[model samples]
Target: MNELQNTLRRLLRVVIGGRWGVFAWSLSGASALAVILWGLKAVAIPLLMIKTASWGIWGLGVIRESKLRTPIRP
Candidate 1:
């Protein structure tokens, strides 16, 4: 029972981690924007552009974090 509780706590912590929040928000926002754009027009070019830009921003953030060598907090 103790081991099961410990494992459950660990999994909960991982699911609720700080980085997960950031990543989830970024992904959700991008998806929402794409959906909005698609509803406005059938063409997918604008949505693609938005997706690329979003990913580019994410990449830049990763690069900056890597260069700073900051330890990611849970």
Candidate 2:
């Protein structure tokens, strides 16, 4: 029972983390601007550009995490 509870907690944390990562990368200020611009038809922004920005955000987060002295654990 304890092991199952631990596994469930880990799974929940991972799911929540993934959602936050997606939101942070894809729904960030720059990404949001790109989306708005695309919506307004002012610029023909490529989907790749948005995806690249999201990857860049993820990369930055990874670098920042590596710089931390202690890794965060749930």
lDDT agreement with native, every candidate: 0.58, 0.56
Q: After superposition, how far is residue 21 of candidate 1 from its true place, in Å?
A: 11
Compared with the true structure, what per-residue lDDT tens digits does model 2 show for residues 8-70? 765554443444455555555665686676663554466556667666656665555444423
Error of 1 at 43 (Å): 5.4
Clashing pairs in 2: none
Output the number of the TM-score-best candidate: 1
Task: Write model 1 residue lDDT over 40-67, tens digit each, in one string.
Answer: 4663676667667756655565555444
Q: After best superposition, candidate 1 residue 6: deviation in angstroms?
A: 21
Instruction: Quote the lDDT for 15 in model 1.
Output: 41
Worst 10 residues of 2 by lDDT: 62-71
Alpha-carbon deviation at 73 in model 1, angstroms: 20
Q: What TM value does model 2 have?
A: 0.37
